[model samples]
Target chain A: MVFTTTKFELLTNKVAASFGLPDARIVTVDHPLGGTDRATIERWADAAVDTVVALLTSG
Target chain B: MADKGELLEIVDASPEAVMDYFDDRGWGDGLPLVPPTVERVEAMLAACGGADPDEVLSVLPPRFGECTRRMVAINAVLAGCRPDVMPVLVTAARALGHPELNLRGVNATTHPVAPLLIVHGDIATSAGYNSGLGAFGPGNRANATTGRAVRFLLLHVAGARPGPGDASTQGQPAKYSYCVAENTAASPWESYPRSVGVDAPSAITLHCGENPHNFHDMEADHPGPILEKAASVMATLGVNNAPIGQGEYFVGLGPEHAATIASHNWTRRDVQSYLYERARLPAGLYRKQFGSLAWFPWMHEVPDDHLMPATGHPDHFKIFVVGGAGKHSCVVPSWGMTKSVTLAVAP
Candidate 1:
């Protein structure tokens, strides 16, 4: 998490090798996270949730 | 008046306090998360038939980590997904694992195009994925959330955060969620999966589409001339022939345009062949002074050369007829200077 842009291959392999999954199974989207991995992932989830909640709540 | 048998200890905690716990722990995508309340998480699990959330889908590489169903649920909840939509998310994730898809490359490249999801069969209509007018735009929950869920999974579960793992150059808006459905009812051709070779009840198909450029031609209805115009745009200076080696292009033929081809009694293959031939650049245009030099190395070697083949192969072009009725059709230029990897949709 909290990654730089344009590292699709490096990141893909990292995620795959980290979890022992093959590289083919993952697709990276362009969402920026601003800290360490654990904190970053949490923030990303929260941001996404906020967008969803805003949409749902407004509707 | 509440009876507390083995009641859990209750403490008032601000929402931010809870978010901090997850956020500071680096357990999220730098955004705060709604705490995975037991009820919410349980509901999510039930949607997937109550499977173990910890079951590993894969151990993502480059960083070496495990992605489990439970973790995915956590992100889905955060992504604002309902439990009922979890099946579609799972299927899409599984499809990303397809070898032909080159997910690793897609995830790491600086290309603006991300995986574009196309749902086919009964599931599309049942799930409320739009294949009609404004299908590419937002509004449908199934289309929006399903696509959002994938992005969430990649960010949280797989950890491809921008400036970290993701490296898209002029990142596209489609990165948020590029899911849509094929307008099978409107399309004159068979389902895309069938064309690509797959049995169908309904499933998802994934492709990579850069910024979509339109080809609006109201002047013509005949398939031959229309496709020639369209193909020329696809192979034109800036937009045409970006494939590095052998690559595929996504051509979404609108119903009105497709109907024109049908009127001329041209099968999809006939149109493909016609476009394939017409899409080629003149040999003289392949010089270093011209921008076609980006793909063909021979251009530099020959200097003022214009005779080298623009595309590595004629079959590099792939067609998928879709969109609502209109004289307009479009080609989603490949972001990579190469062909996109195609993967099958899974159950």
Candidate 2:
């Protein structure tokens, strides 16, 4: 699974496609990872974890 | 002999027209370029001493274009490099091609870093590369053109064009043309290439680095105080080395500073060890700067108050004496994952 920022979506999608990974395996957060407070980071982490769990369990 | 590649004719145009043609096609680096006429390209190839023009040097990434000797010569001619500098450009390209250097990641990342070409040995003097006053600045043909050729290769051959591939948010000026030779004659220790086990007349080491940050210490006559000055710069939280935790860092010591440090009975190893010990950030400070997400699992579990070394090991701190007639030194921060690669220049 890959986790990247929305700004890097174009690049991340290109890489994922190159590696032949399905869309379900890729997760994107917001762009500009800088200036983000700890609370925001934790929230993103929680959301990412849930996404990974859902992706794995749905299979 | 020029390899059989596609050719174009300007149809009796003026020099400005030729420049316009290249600029229109996005072939020039936003600077005036010497037109790569067939004669000039063949002259560069001839300087390669009968090496096969078709010899594939490396496959550059993002676009994954295969760079051949003939292609390099064409870029060299376009960059206005003299024939003698071709070998240095070739060696530098080969060093970047090394997997350990991770050129692909370097080109793709948003990090403000570029490959710095550091030349060591007698060829530096023979090629008239500036290792003295204003060495890192302009006015020297060898230093300027050799670096420009590599930049063009990255753009045209490697496909690291800005925006699409090179995602540098605010790229430093060094990305324009960053190349310097070691002032070996004035150094208090062995030349950098020799220290790294290459005994060639000239060798090029490609380092993925940022612009040099000046570390001034004119008042410090003692090595201890001089090193303290360096440690302060190295441990700055703004640099990638601080939060990332493991990367090779370079300290370019001026001649006077190197002599002062040598007077204190310190070998290069001693200096590296000293810097490694002092160039550290407290875990608390790291946490304050980066918060809890900054902690990498591989980092040794240390308390918040514990001091963490900037690099993984002492040897990761590469110290070389360069510059001319000053107490001013510089700390070149790395791109964080790439290791420097040194290769001998082909005769």
Candidate 3:
């Protein structure tokens, strides 16, 4: 599974396809990942945790 | 010779209409483009001296588009490049695909880094490249269009469009066109390629770095004060090289500055040594700011207040003379993970 931000959602999709991973599992979060506060990042991580776990467990 | 991609058919419209069509499709670089007719592309490809037009030279990133001789020539025509400049662009495309360059990360990172092409040897003159006063700036056709052709490959083939594929925070002017030729005759040292042990009659070095940051000192008769100032510029907290120990810095010394430094009987290695020893900051400062410090083992073992050099070694300071008669010099900071590649232009 791949973790990315919305700003890179399209690029992730394109790059994944190019590498022959057309069905690569990707979990996308909101934009502006680097410049945010710790609490905000933690919140984003918490929100995306469920999707990451599901991708890890299922086909 | 076969074309690489599918042929597009458009109406025989006015020049303005054609420009509009290209702009709508994201082909225009906010500047007017020369209509790349099939004849012009064929003429540009003919300059390659029998290289197969359909041969895939490089597989560019983001889109993984196959870059063939035909596509490069087509983009060259669109950039208004003369047939003589084809060899430089072809060599640069190969350099872009080199693993050392890390072009994928260069395009993906939010840092405003662009590839700066330095043309060398007979081709620099035969192709009419500007290496004299204001070389990095505009005013020369061969330099301008050849540089633009490289960018067009990123745009058309690699699909590194500004918003999506490039992802730069605040894209710089160098992203449009960044190229210059070494003023080898004006310099005190040998040609840059030869200095680096690439003994080709003609070559090109593609370094992915921020735009040139000019530093000028008019009254310095000796190399000490002038070089010390350059070290101070490198030690700044804002530059990406501070935390990344392996980062490379290309210091372009103006001819007058090079002459002054040479008067001290300083070789290129001497300048590199001086800059490496001086371009430093307190290790504590780096630790306080960034969460992770990507340094060498010795750098990591140093005490908090110990002064650490900007990069790992003196060899990281790649020195060469550029520009015309002036006391001005410039430093180009790398994007940290990428390495510059120098290759001979194909005959």
Proportion of true inter-chain contacts also present in candidate 3 = 0.52
B26: Cα error in model 2, Å: 2.2
Write the residue-wise lDDT of candidate 3 on B60-109 in tens digits: 89777788888899899889899999999999989999998998999888
The CAPRI class of candidate 2 is incorrect
lDDT of each: 0.63, 0.83, 0.89
lDDT of 2 by residue, B238-330 (tens): 887677755878889999999999998899999999998998888777877775333346554778888877776888888887788878999
The CAPRI category of model 1 is: acceptable
TM-score (chain A only) of candidate 1 = 0.29
The 10-residue segment of model 3 chain B with minimum total lDDT is: B1-10
- Which pairs clash (backbone N, Cα, C closer than 3 Å) in model 2? none
Q: Tens digits of per-residue lDDT for model 1 on B175-271?
A: 8877778888988888877776776677677676675677877867578777876777677656434434345667888888888788878887887
Q: In DockQ, how does model 3 score against the reference complex?
A: 0.64
TM-score of 2: 0.88
What lDDT score goes with residue B250 in model 2?
87
Share of native interface contacts recovered by each model = 0.57, 0.00, 0.52
Instruction: lDDT for model 2, please.
Output: 0.83
Where does candidate 3 stray beyond 4 Å? B1-3
